[model samples]
Target: MGDGDRRLTVNGSLRSVPANPPRSLLDVLRYDLGLTGTKYGCGEGRCGACTVLLDGVPVNACQIPVDEVGDRSITTVEGLASRGELNAVQQAFAELGAFQCGFCTPGMIVRATALLRDDPSPSETEIRAALNGNLCRCCGYPRIVRAVERASEIGRSGGGRP
Candidate 1:
Protein backbone atom coordinates (compact mmCIF):
# COMPACT_ATOMS: atom_id res chain seq x y z
CA MET A 1 0.00 0.00 0.00
CA GLY A 2 1.08 3.54 -0.62
CA ASP A 3 1.73 6.13 2.07
CA GLY A 4 -1.74 7.67 1.74
CA ASP A 5 -3.57 4.41 1.26
CA ARG A 6 -5.57 2.46 3.80
CA ARG A 7 -7.49 -0.80 3.82
CA LEU A 8 -10.83 -1.16 5.58
CA THR A 9 -13.58 -3.68 5.90
CA VAL A 10 -17.00 -2.61 4.58
CA ASN A 11 -20.08 -4.74 4.47
CA GLY A 12 -18.17 -7.97 5.11
CA SER A 13 -15.55 -7.26 2.46
CA LEU A 14 -12.03 -5.92 2.61
CA ARG A 15 -11.15 -3.10 0.25
CA SER A 16 -8.05 -0.97 -0.12
CA VAL A 17 -8.17 2.48 -1.60
CA PRO A 18 -6.34 5.76 -1.60
CA ALA A 19 -6.91 7.89 1.44
CA ASN A 20 -7.78 11.14 -0.19
CA PRO A 21 -6.68 14.05 1.92
CA PRO A 22 -9.94 16.01 1.74
CA ARG A 23 -12.44 13.37 0.73
CA SER A 24 -14.68 11.84 3.36
CA LEU A 25 -15.71 8.23 3.86
CA LEU A 26 -18.94 8.99 2.00
CA ASP A 27 -16.92 9.72 -1.10
CA VAL A 28 -14.89 6.57 -0.65
CA LEU A 29 -17.95 4.37 -0.18
CA ARG A 30 -19.95 5.87 -3.02
CA TYR A 31 -17.21 6.68 -5.49
CA ASP A 32 -14.38 4.27 -4.73
CA LEU A 33 -16.39 1.36 -3.35
CA GLY A 34 -19.71 1.76 -5.21
CA LEU A 35 -21.82 1.81 -2.05
CA THR A 36 -24.22 4.74 -2.35
CA GLY A 37 -26.95 3.92 0.12
CA THR A 38 -25.40 6.44 2.49
CA LYS A 39 -26.71 9.72 1.08
CA TYR A 40 -25.36 13.25 1.23
CA GLY A 41 -28.02 15.43 2.81
CA CYS A 42 -26.20 18.28 4.46
CA GLY A 43 -22.54 17.28 4.03
CA GLU A 44 -22.20 18.81 7.49
CA GLY A 45 -23.20 15.67 9.37
CA ARG A 46 -26.29 17.29 10.85
CA CYS A 47 -28.85 15.74 8.52
CA GLY A 48 -27.87 12.17 9.23
CA ALA A 49 -28.21 11.37 5.54
CA CYS A 50 -24.65 10.11 5.48
CA THR A 51 -25.05 7.94 8.54
CA VAL A 52 -23.32 4.55 8.63
CA LEU A 53 -22.36 2.06 11.28
CA LEU A 54 -18.70 2.09 12.19
CA ASP A 55 -18.12 -0.69 14.70
CA GLY A 56 -21.89 -0.83 15.33
CA VAL A 57 -22.15 2.87 16.21
CA PRO A 58 -23.79 5.39 13.95
CA VAL A 59 -21.59 8.11 12.47
CA ASN A 60 -21.90 10.57 9.64
CA ALA A 61 -19.85 9.27 6.76
CA CYS A 62 -19.27 12.75 5.36
CA GLN A 63 -17.48 13.73 8.56
CA ILE A 64 -15.10 10.77 8.54
CA PRO A 65 -12.04 10.13 6.43
CA VAL A 66 -11.21 6.88 4.73
CA ASP A 67 -7.91 6.52 6.60
CA GLU A 68 -9.63 7.07 9.92
CA VAL A 69 -11.94 4.10 9.44
CA GLY A 70 -9.02 1.72 10.02
CA ASP A 71 -10.12 -1.86 10.60
CA ARG A 72 -13.56 -1.19 12.00
CA SER A 73 -16.56 -2.96 10.60
CA ILE A 74 -18.59 -0.57 8.45
CA THR A 75 -22.24 -1.31 7.91
CA THR A 76 -24.16 0.76 5.40
CA VAL A 77 -27.81 0.56 4.45
CA GLU A 78 -26.88 -1.98 1.83
CA GLY A 79 -25.72 -4.35 4.53
CA LEU A 80 -29.01 -4.27 6.39
CA ALA A 81 -30.58 -7.10 4.46
CA SER A 82 -29.57 -10.73 4.23
CA ARG A 83 -30.43 -13.15 1.41
CA GLY A 84 -32.47 -10.48 -0.38
CA GLU A 85 -34.77 -10.10 2.61
CA LEU A 86 -35.17 -6.80 4.36
CA ASN A 87 -34.23 -6.54 8.02
CA ALA A 88 -36.80 -6.02 10.77
CA VAL A 89 -36.47 -2.27 10.86
CA GLN A 90 -36.63 -2.04 7.11
CA GLN A 91 -39.68 -4.27 6.94
CA ALA A 92 -41.39 -2.22 9.58
CA PHE A 93 -40.58 1.00 7.79
CA ALA A 94 -42.07 -0.33 4.62
CA GLU A 95 -45.12 -1.81 6.23
CA LEU A 96 -45.87 1.36 8.13
CA GLY A 97 -45.11 3.69 5.20
CA ALA A 98 -42.70 5.46 7.44
CA PHE A 99 -41.09 7.22 4.49
CA GLN A 100 -42.52 9.55 1.93
CA CYS A 101 -39.59 11.10 0.12
CA GLY A 102 -37.44 8.11 1.07
CA PHE A 103 -34.31 10.24 1.06
CA CYS A 104 -33.83 9.74 4.78
CA THR A 105 -34.89 6.12 4.89
CA PRO A 106 -31.44 4.62 4.62
CA GLY A 107 -29.94 6.66 7.42
CA MET A 108 -33.02 6.27 9.58
CA ILE A 109 -32.92 2.55 9.06
CA VAL A 110 -29.21 2.33 9.84
CA ARG A 111 -29.56 4.34 13.02
CA ALA A 112 -32.64 2.38 14.05
CA THR A 113 -30.77 -0.87 13.50
CA ALA A 114 -28.22 0.13 16.11
CA LEU A 115 -30.95 1.39 18.39
CA LEU A 116 -32.83 -1.90 18.36
CA ARG A 117 -29.64 -3.85 18.92
CA ASP A 118 -28.99 -1.78 22.02
CA ASP A 119 -32.61 -1.62 23.20
CA PRO A 120 -34.98 -3.98 21.53
CA SER A 121 -37.93 -2.22 23.08
CA PRO A 122 -37.10 1.44 23.12
CA SER A 123 -39.79 3.93 24.05
CA GLU A 124 -41.02 6.47 21.54
CA THR A 125 -38.86 9.06 23.18
CA GLU A 126 -35.88 6.78 22.94
CA ILE A 127 -36.62 6.12 19.31
CA ARG A 128 -36.94 9.84 18.66
CA ALA A 129 -33.61 10.48 20.33
CA ALA A 130 -31.94 7.77 18.30
CA LEU A 131 -33.25 9.20 15.04
CA ASN A 132 -32.88 12.83 15.97
CA GLY A 133 -30.08 13.28 13.51
CA ASN A 134 -31.91 11.88 10.53
CA LEU A 135 -34.33 14.34 8.95
CA CYS A 136 -37.25 13.71 6.70
CA ARG A 137 -38.76 16.71 4.95
CA CYS A 138 -42.01 14.85 4.54
CA CYS A 139 -42.78 15.06 8.23
CA GLY A 140 -42.92 11.33 8.75
CA TYR A 141 -41.89 11.25 12.39
CA PRO A 142 -45.14 9.76 13.67
CA ARG A 143 -45.00 6.86 11.28
CA ILE A 144 -41.28 6.48 11.67
CA VAL A 145 -41.72 6.12 15.38
CA ARG A 146 -44.43 3.61 14.82
CA ALA A 147 -42.14 1.73 12.46
CA VAL A 148 -39.41 1.48 15.05
CA GLU A 149 -41.95 0.29 17.61
CA ARG A 150 -43.13 -2.30 15.16
CA ALA A 151 -39.58 -3.38 14.46
CA SER A 152 -39.00 -3.98 18.15
CA GLU A 153 -42.07 -6.18 18.28
CA ILE A 154 -40.92 -8.00 15.20
CA GLY A 155 -37.54 -8.58 16.77
CA ARG A 156 -39.11 -10.23 19.80
CA SER A 157 -41.63 -12.22 17.78
CA GLY A 158 -38.98 -13.70 15.49
CA GLY A 159 -40.89 -12.33 12.55
CA GLY A 160 -39.50 -10.65 9.44
CA ARG A 161 -36.33 -12.71 10.06
CA PRO A 162 -34.49 -9.55 11.07
Candidate 2:
Protein backbone atom coordinates (compact mmCIF):
# COMPACT_ATOMS: atom_id res chain seq x y z
CA MET A 1 0.00 0.00 0.00
CA GLY A 2 3.03 2.26 0.13
CA ASP A 3 4.40 4.39 -2.71
CA GLY A 4 7.36 2.06 -3.11
CA ASP A 5 5.02 -0.90 -3.73
CA ARG A 6 2.21 -1.72 -6.14
CA ARG A 7 -0.70 -3.97 -5.34
CA LEU A 8 -2.76 -6.07 -7.77
CA THR A 9 -5.64 -8.46 -7.46
CA VAL A 10 -4.68 -11.45 -9.54
CA ASN A 11 -6.54 -14.69 -9.82
CA GLY A 12 -8.67 -13.66 -6.87
CA SER A 13 -5.64 -12.93 -4.68
CA LEU A 14 -4.13 -9.67 -3.54
CA ARG A 15 -0.43 -9.35 -4.35
CA SER A 16 2.15 -6.63 -3.93
CA VAL A 17 5.15 -5.76 -6.07
CA PRO A 18 7.77 -3.02 -6.22
CA ALA A 19 6.48 0.20 -7.77
CA ASN A 20 9.78 1.66 -8.92
CA PRO A 21 11.47 0.48 -12.11
CA PRO A 22 8.17 0.18 -13.80
CA ARG A 23 7.51 -2.90 -15.91
CA SER A 24 4.69 -4.29 -18.00
CA LEU A 25 1.97 -6.39 -16.40
CA LEU A 26 3.26 -9.38 -18.36
CA ASP A 27 6.66 -9.18 -16.70
CA VAL A 28 5.01 -8.68 -13.34
CA LEU A 29 2.81 -11.72 -13.83
CA ARG A 30 5.48 -14.02 -15.26
CA TYR A 31 8.53 -12.92 -13.27
CA ASP A 32 7.34 -11.05 -10.21
CA LEU A 33 4.46 -13.30 -9.19
CA GLY A 34 5.59 -16.53 -10.84
CA LEU A 35 2.35 -16.82 -12.80
CA THR A 36 3.97 -18.04 -16.00
CA GLY A 37 0.76 -19.05 -17.77
CA THR A 38 0.63 -15.60 -19.38
CA LYS A 39 3.19 -15.74 -22.18
CA TYR A 40 5.41 -12.97 -23.54
CA GLY A 41 5.17 -12.58 -27.29
CA CYS A 42 6.31 -9.62 -29.36
CA GLY A 43 6.85 -7.18 -26.49
CA GLU A 44 4.66 -4.83 -28.53
CA GLY A 45 0.87 -5.23 -28.28
CA ARG A 46 0.58 -6.72 -31.75
CA CYS A 47 0.68 -10.36 -30.72
CA GLY A 48 -2.06 -11.68 -28.48
CA ALA A 49 0.21 -14.20 -26.76
CA CYS A 50 0.24 -12.05 -23.66
CA THR A 51 -3.52 -11.76 -23.38
CA VAL A 52 -5.12 -11.56 -19.94
CA LEU A 53 -8.40 -10.34 -18.52
CA LEU A 54 -8.29 -6.91 -17.02
CA ASP A 55 -11.41 -6.92 -14.86
CA GLY A 56 -13.27 -9.29 -17.13
CA VAL A 57 -12.03 -7.77 -20.42
CA PRO A 58 -9.25 -9.23 -22.56
CA VAL A 59 -6.09 -7.16 -23.05
CA ASN A 60 -2.47 -7.57 -23.99
CA ALA A 61 -0.60 -7.75 -20.73
CA CYS A 62 2.66 -6.72 -22.39
CA GLN A 63 1.18 -3.28 -23.15
CA ILE A 64 -0.04 -2.58 -19.62
CA PRO A 65 2.32 -1.28 -16.97
CA VAL A 66 2.09 -2.91 -13.57
CA ASP A 67 1.75 0.46 -11.87
CA GLU A 68 -1.41 1.17 -13.88
CA VAL A 69 -3.00 -2.13 -12.86
CA GLY A 70 -3.87 -0.73 -9.44
CA ASP A 71 -6.78 -2.75 -7.96
CA ARG A 72 -8.08 -4.26 -11.23
CA SER A 73 -8.42 -8.00 -11.04
CA ILE A 74 -6.09 -9.77 -13.45
CA THR A 75 -7.34 -13.07 -14.72
CA THR A 76 -4.63 -14.98 -16.50
CA VAL A 77 -5.05 -18.34 -18.18
CA GLU A 78 -4.47 -19.84 -14.76
CA GLY A 79 -7.45 -17.95 -13.40
CA LEU A 80 -9.97 -19.23 -15.96
CA ALA A 81 -10.52 -22.42 -14.07
CA SER A 82 -12.52 -22.77 -10.92
CA ARG A 83 -11.82 -25.31 -8.17
CA GLY A 84 -9.78 -28.11 -9.81
CA GLU A 85 -11.70 -28.33 -13.05
CA LEU A 86 -11.04 -26.65 -16.39
CA ASN A 87 -13.44 -24.05 -17.74
CA ALA A 88 -15.60 -24.80 -20.78
CA VAL A 89 -13.23 -23.22 -23.30
CA GLN A 90 -10.25 -25.03 -21.84
CA GLN A 91 -12.08 -28.32 -21.80
CA ALA A 92 -13.17 -27.89 -25.39
CA PHE A 93 -9.65 -27.00 -26.50
CA ALA A 94 -8.28 -30.11 -24.85
CA GLU A 95 -11.08 -32.35 -25.98
CA LEU A 96 -10.97 -31.16 -29.59
CA GLY A 97 -7.18 -30.95 -29.86
CA ALA A 98 -7.28 -27.29 -30.79
CA PHE A 99 -3.60 -26.60 -30.21
CA GLN A 100 -0.42 -27.85 -31.84
CA CYS A 101 2.55 -25.96 -30.42
CA GLY A 102 0.59 -24.95 -27.32
CA PHE A 103 2.54 -21.71 -26.94
CA CYS A 104 -0.46 -19.69 -28.10
CA THR A 105 -3.01 -21.82 -26.37
CA PRO A 106 -3.07 -19.72 -23.23
CA GLY A 107 -3.92 -16.53 -25.04
CA MET A 108 -6.38 -18.26 -27.30
CA ILE A 109 -8.11 -19.82 -24.33
CA VAL A 110 -8.26 -16.55 -22.41
CA ARG A 111 -9.65 -14.65 -25.38
CA ALA A 112 -12.11 -17.41 -26.16
CA THR A 113 -13.22 -17.45 -22.57
CA ALA A 114 -14.12 -13.77 -22.77
CA LEU A 115 -15.83 -14.26 -26.08
CA LEU A 116 -17.97 -17.06 -24.77
CA ARG A 117 -18.89 -15.05 -21.72
CA ASP A 118 -20.21 -12.34 -23.97
CA ASP A 119 -21.72 -14.63 -26.57
CA PRO A 120 -22.41 -18.13 -25.39
CA SER A 121 -22.96 -19.18 -28.96
CA PRO A 122 -20.81 -17.32 -31.42
CA SER A 123 -20.92 -18.25 -35.11
CA GLU A 124 -17.88 -19.47 -37.01
CA THR A 125 -17.25 -16.00 -38.38
CA GLU A 126 -17.67 -14.50 -34.94
CA ILE A 127 -15.31 -17.01 -33.41
CA ARG A 128 -12.75 -16.40 -36.11
CA ALA A 129 -13.07 -12.66 -35.71
CA ALA A 130 -12.79 -12.92 -31.95
CA LEU A 131 -9.61 -14.97 -32.16
CA ASN A 132 -8.13 -13.14 -35.12
CA GLY A 133 -5.75 -11.24 -32.90
CA ASN A 134 -4.37 -14.45 -31.43
CA LEU A 135 -1.99 -16.19 -33.80
CA CYS A 136 -1.27 -19.90 -34.04
CA ARG A 137 1.85 -20.62 -36.10
CA CYS A 138 0.83 -24.25 -36.40
CA CYS A 139 -2.14 -23.24 -38.58
CA GLY A 140 -4.59 -24.67 -36.11
CA TYR A 141 -7.27 -22.08 -36.90
CA PRO A 142 -9.86 -24.63 -37.97
CA ARG A 143 -9.55 -26.68 -34.84
CA ILE A 144 -9.41 -23.58 -32.71
CA VAL A 145 -12.63 -22.25 -34.20
CA ARG A 146 -14.29 -25.60 -33.76
CA ALA A 147 -13.12 -25.70 -30.19
CA VAL A 148 -14.89 -22.42 -29.53
CA GLU A 149 -18.04 -23.84 -31.04
CA ARG A 150 -17.61 -26.93 -28.94
CA ALA A 151 -17.17 -24.77 -25.89
CA SER A 152 -20.45 -23.05 -26.68
CA GLU A 153 -22.15 -26.39 -26.97
CA ILE A 154 -20.67 -27.61 -23.74
CA GLY A 155 -21.70 -24.45 -21.95
CA ARG A 156 -25.27 -24.63 -23.24
CA SER A 157 -25.56 -28.28 -22.31
CA GLY A 158 -24.28 -27.57 -18.84
CA GLY A 159 -21.82 -30.40 -19.38
CA GLY A 160 -18.65 -28.53 -18.52
CA ARG A 161 -20.18 -26.52 -15.66
CA PRO A 162 -18.66 -23.33 -17.06
Best by TM-score: 2
* Residue-level lDDT tens digits of model 1 in 25-120: 999999988898889899998899889999999999999977678789999999989989999999999989889889999999999999999998
Can you give the TM-score per candidate against the true fold? Answer: 0.93, 0.96
Model 2 misplaced regions, further than 4 Å? 1-3
Cα deviation of 60, candidate 2, in Å: 0.2
- lDDT score of residue 117 within candidate 1: 93
Q: Deviation in angstroms for 20 in model 1?
A: 3.2
Report the C-alpha lDDT of model 2 over 1-162, residue by residue, as the tens digit. 688887889999998888879899999999989999899879898879999999999999999988788788999999888888999999999999999889899999999999999999899999999998998888899999999999999999997744
Instruction: Please report the candidate that would top lDDT against the real structure.
Output: 2
Looking at model 2, residue 45 earns an lDDT score of 87
